[model samples]
Target: MFIQSQPADPAIHDKALRIANETLFIIRCLMREEEWGDYLREAYIIARRILEEKP
Candidate 1:
């Protein structure tokens, strides 16, 4: 992960970390409702699709 400073291209490290944290939060919320498996499956699918679309 990269963090950009002035005079450098914007880095996506912070954004990536935020997304990871959000995913963990979602998993925790889902687990409380006994929905962790479903949430994980959906998250995996969405992540794969996103990766496939990345340049």
Candidate 2:
């Protein structure tokens, strides 16, 4: 989702994709256990941070 909003810079785009993918992967793991409330929220916060940090 966030990946689609990335800029044209290959480096920043790649970094955003990687961060989003890793965050989603962790969320998926939590979802498997049906225990992702706080974790998912944290993941979104981190995603926003990733977006802010990108150039």
Q: Please report, in order, the local distance difference test score of every candidate based on alpha carbons.
A: 0.49, 0.57
Q: Show the lowest summed lDDT stretch of 10 residues, model 1.
A: 1-10
Q: Report the lDDT tens digits of candidate 2 across residue range 1-55.
A: 3443544456655665566667777557547545555555465556555665646
Measured by TM-score, the strongest candidate is 1
Query: Model 1 compared with the native: what TM-score?
Result: 0.44
lDDT of 1 at 39: 66
Model 1: per-residue Cα lDDT over 1-55, one tens digit each: 2222322222333444445557968558536656755665565445444533436
Residue 27, candidate 1: how far off, in angstroms? Answer: 4.8
